[model samples]
Target: MNKYLLTIFTLFIAMSGFAESPDSTEIAIKEIEQSLQYQTGTIKLKEGHGTLIVPKGFHFLDQEQSKYVLSDLWGNPEDNTIIGMLFPIHVGVLDDHSWGFTISYDPMGYVKDDDANTINYDDLLASNKKDILAENQERLNSGYGTIELIGWASTPYYDSNKKVLHWAKEIKFDGDSANTLNYNLRVLGREGIYLVNAVASMDELPEVNKNLDQLIASVQFDNGYKYEDYTDGDQIASWTVGGLVAGKILAKTGFFAAILKFWKIIAVGIAGGFSFLWKKIRGRNENDTIEAPTKPIQEENDEDSTKS
Candidate 1:
């Protein structure tokens, strides 16, 4: 009877310990969230470009944390192309499954809008698929999975009045279980363009589109930086709306292929990174917090203004 009771007590203890593990994990997540100090409200963009009015249901991660999340957590190269990040308010900072948007600016000079209504999207899509197919070999050689452009999740639409070009692509990364939805928003300006790229699963495209209008409305250029402010002497970007949709601009930025690899990491992070971060955070003292770093958003660039 004593041996049986001891065995029963040991099993009970084991069960209790297992039950407590989840609670501990939850606590760790909460702590990490608190430490991150995620901000909300209007976040001013670098170089007097504009301000991002972070929507009511989202929070903004500043430049430093954004870079860390992309480079360290998401396994992308440490590039200054990232200006900041927009995260859903309901999700934890480390929650990878939830969709978030990365903001970047390309000072590739004024992008002319002459091709707004003239280009054929069907032809453009065909050309883009060929370009992607040709690039797949390089991606494979580099150890990144190849991608297939399934179709446009959301057709290209330009708001000429707002100078905002928005489109979405349905992409399948080789070996990925679910298709990826790449939503692109280009906010044209006098000096360059602001790129808002949202990476999410195809299933979440509807949810992403639902918030598109609000997100587009939230960004505005400062005075004298609007597209209408462009002068005849101002430099023009080598590409146009059609090229933008075709990923030509991204290719010049040298981020096109890296983006493919980056998204893979994002998928893995969402699927598994949270628990890993939870474990790391749990090892730290409960009282510890990751103080938000104060860093300027602008980084130095020496590239010619005419290049895109």
Candidate 2:
């Protein structure tokens, strides 16, 4: 009787192992492939300010679906400030590796570039580190992980010709094994700034920087909204380049905390997400289905059509 019971237990363990095999997981994933969808091409920004020319090897997620991914799927708090998202063309919403970056507009008034030439990034980084330390308790109290600024992955670079400011930071979050790469691009405009915040693992900095120039060039402000269009009566942003780099604007706009909390999820997800999407995208001619354009026109109320 004891031998019979032991044999039954061994059989149950064997069956359980088979049930959880990788092949079964793959079969389940394939079954839901038809329901999974992704969007690419041009994505119009809020208030008809401009359009992000979603590059050839990328896709865009509209505001609502983007919010869901950030808040529900990735476990970040809901952020209404996010206007849209840019994802690699190969990845879908369910992919676990990475989701790419978010696009947000801050109508904080025109920022002056007077201080761009003289600001010291080393000092700015030190100041930012102090600020992070000061805010860590607040983050802990809010149920989020504390972050340490490991230093700049890429120092601030501003293009006066294009009115674009770009920077990258290496950050370490509590309990996370990998460091987070926070790449920021701010396009100054007549009314405010267009922000592209891309978070990924530190290892992806090269890939992220390689695409940064093209992405920055793709964002075009409307005719009357360019940085040069700012008039005498237009409101001026209270902060300048130094303030922006020191995380003053980020703190004021409530993005500093959100970014810190979300990088942990991004670090874990990007590798798997990129790999899985690459496989799916390589399986088909995705470019043949989506129109790749230099500057695409905005479609009225087109956000709903792109929903998966």
Candidate 3:
């Protein structure tokens, strides 16, 4: 979601790094966690397309509770698109150290993986950084701070056998000391893909990495929708696995709404011209900027040629 005003109060907690919790807030948060009924074992994903096996030492929440926690407790905007969330069983959703996976699926048509092994990620990352740089002015124009793509937190990896692709990103928002971890996993299917994104601060990198394999294994599309079930004449996706990891898909699909953890934007302050201090639900409002005007700026830059 970029730095457009969607930082989780939970993220704020993580960034605060051991800030003492107010007794009332602490008790209220704990009561909220206790109030919900979390699920375990086999869980069906949105629209019965696939299934998520609540992996060992984790718990699952359906869309309702997930939205409440994300928008209400964590300070993310009201995103009705989320199918659910996954949390470590040991951690309270209110815990400062808490982190979880927000789940959603996109039927963007069958994704062909022929280019999987052919991509040069180093070159791709450079291109992505350029895209991010190009969008900063727009971010400022829309009342958000610039996003700094610090590079990959984990290099992209494709599992041909499993029909899944996963990667991690290191991102920094202006005016914040701590960086956000944007971990992404994509599961290809006959009609679309499942997006499993883990949102956390940089300090949780090791734990997230350690648990990724099993997490990737948790999502399984139903028989006819499985990647291997792609028959001739199926609707093909416009982008490939590389595009998913590059954040380009955000413009074309609803796949990775939280990729930048629009929930990661807490406060934004710009020096000259634009300044935004955000403190409320800010994720979905920023989603409007998805197809926001980057190319138009390129067209404006072409003014030099026009004058000549």
Candidate 4:
């Protein structure tokens, strides 16, 4: 971690030519690394929902740490809805090649799986592409780069017995040389769905896809909240298997709002995140917005896309 900080700081100094206080840089880096507090073993989910048995070669950061990584390290706006994050042991959260699964649970209630087997993922993919095209004008109007839905890296698959749905999408942001990967997992519970989203570049698709099953097996709802525990009059989710597969996107604000989230990836790697780090290391006013350091844009994100 110290090495990573040093490397980034060295690059920061070289790029900006600011021989700023090394003491401050070292301290901030130490604080940020310590803030991660990555752990393994059994992790009890909040609200008695379930447990995450973090596998070997991986680490889990609880809500506070996850929020810090997302908002601070990743240069994203603060989002408290996230439950945690899962990362492999090999990479620091700040690594340019870093990728992780963000975990957030939505108590949207029991989602019936009657349509699980019937969903035509190819049709859904076509619809998603059209939606992206339809929304590109608004994105251009908003002075943001248009997003291209390149189709599924992994087609949607739902396991009715386990009440789980998962899929992956390959997306391209305007002007970017590389594409982004959005891998989603929905584990239905008696009262809600657990949303696990993998954020990475398409370069990591093989790795993310390889571990999908293991990651899926790690999260399990506690006894009463298990899928089979649904009762006669319990709350029900409006989404079905298809909706879960279409998780982060909507016909409405989905892709537009997701811009706030995905653009951070631009800053973190493609655009050089040194400015965000410099400000954090040097300290800043509380009211200042944490943006992706890319283009200046609106802050609305896919809160509904993730939590609702």
Candidate 5:
């Protein structure tokens, strides 16, 4: 009997320990929802994962052109606000070669040129000089071929094609790596994606590589996501240092389904487990209090019987 009672007590203690706590997912979701206010949609928290996707006109990027032109109650386009949809993002991949955009909140952690200079896609486009373009071409023809030029820029190859300026940057991974075709990115068209930024490194990061591919696959475009007039040039063998391209491209990449599945399981599981533990602890504490008074009453009755 004693052995049985001790075993039961141990089991109860273990369950109670788990029941008293909230999981990380539940706490994170609650905090995220409170921090971000949703205007027209809902916030769904998945188990074990801290991911949210606010699909409708949510600005994930917060650069200068990312503001929303909102109309007033009178329905006139008079009020402009910082509008954004919050999507569920996870650290599915990390390391270099994985493609992703810089969060408006993150100040560091991106690719730079050999001179340790950072490239801004917008600033570079606005600052390109005619003399610099000519000098770059001369070097390319002489077989020095050292300059890095992207498809959407005013480079000679892109300008020649004029109609297909939708092509973005081409990066050279390891010249020895077998996955060249897929890795050589042709931003397809300007209608499909927004070029955030690019970072580079020499480490072999499989998870980051996989996630980068996944991110690329998740890109899509809406009805207005088409590019009307643009130019393209012949493919350059290399990209010049300090050059960049950033724009809102079309969303043709297919990544939503995978992202959904991975995070949903994590968020739900964490929240559910935490809530269950909290209830169990409360119940155990109540039982202990109820038994306390009965023990004293039984002791008093035993003393009276012994005196009689």
Candidate 6:
């Protein structure tokens, strides 16, 4: 009986400990979903060129009668005149104590084929990768601050005429572990909407790499929104990523464990009751009284008076 009781008590303690640990995947998804829901209205696409860059403080926007809304860092609605396609980039969560990081990207819209095809083949085919870095360095030296390189990858892109000329770069980031995850999709060229990508990190936990591919896959251009519609074939793109993050957030938040916490509460109550009963019993035994006091009398004097 004692062994059985001890086993149950040990199990109770173990379960209580498990309840304290939190999951990040679960937390991130919910957070992502909440952010998406509030994001309503239309996003006015901002355009940029290969050489002539878009001005700073530019952003996506949507006025009334739109399903999405975007603003500049200063909260001003982005201008539609220069807008092209929406690119949502960098979506993630960062926690300091756990040490984590995540980043992702999604692309959309179509740029002019001839314009996109104008790539510096000689520069790209050059044997020295350092040359590319050197050029980036020159730009930094001129006016741009120190540039931090994350990771980059190039994928093939084809136009309606089956002309393969465009490519996309996947960029990552590094910074304070506690910084809120940032997602930015700057429309460099119109082809496809770029999914929002971001990196998240926690100080103690391993970085939870954000999967941009999933977000990218979620995109679907509205009907007749493709390059073909504007140029030759089709250009419409459409996608949704809230669900992917939602799953991760659910896992990380320990929401599953929330149900388990109910059992923990019961265990705690039983343990507390046992402790109270044990204390009460111990106190009663420890405070037991030994004996009662009695009084003496003047019996001799009373007998003498009776005899007289």
Candidate that scores best on TM-score: 4
| lDDT of the candidates, in the order given | 0.62, 0.60, 0.63, 0.65, 0.25, 0.25
lDDT, candidate 6, 1-308, per-residue tens? 11222333454465544332233324422443244321213332332212111222222222211111111110112222222222222321111111111111224335344433444433433322342244444433332212222322333233434322222222211121222222222222245432232222221112222333333323333444433446555443331121111111110101000111222333343334333322322233355442211111101000000000
Q: Model 4 residue 92 lDDT?
A: 67
Global fold similarity of model 5 (TM-score):
0.22
Candidate 4 residue lDDT tens string, 29-118: 555566567889999987438899997678999897776666546534455667888998997665557788888778888888888778
The number of residue pairs in model 5 that clash at the backbone is 43
Worst 10 residues of 2 by lDDT: 299-308
lDDT of 6 at 154: 32
Tens digits of per-residue lDDT, candidate 2, 267-300, equal 2322233233223323332444432111111111
Ranking of models by lDDT: 4, 3, 1, 2, 6, 5
Better of 2 and 6 by lDDT: 2
TM-score per candidate, in order? 0.73, 0.72, 0.74, 0.75, 0.22, 0.27
Better of 2 and 3 by TM-score: 3
Pairs clashing within candidate 3: 6-263, 6-265, 7-264, 7-265
Alpha-carbon runs more than 4 Å astray in model 2: 1-37, 92-96, 249-308
Q: Which candidate is the best by lDDT?
A: 4
Instruction: Kindly list the per-residue Cα lDDT of model 1 for residues 1-308, writing each as its tens digit.
Output: 11222232344444443333444544544564676658887878875389999987988988877765554334344457777888788865445465678787887788878888987889878876786677666555544456687888888998999999988777776666677777788888998888887756777678788888899998889888899998889989886766677654221222221232333322233233333333332334345344212221111111212000
lDDT of 5: 0.25
Worst 10 residues of 3 by lDDT: 299-308
Off by over 4 Å in 4: 1-15, 19-31, 137-143, 247-308
| Residue 257 C-alpha lDDT in model 1 | 16
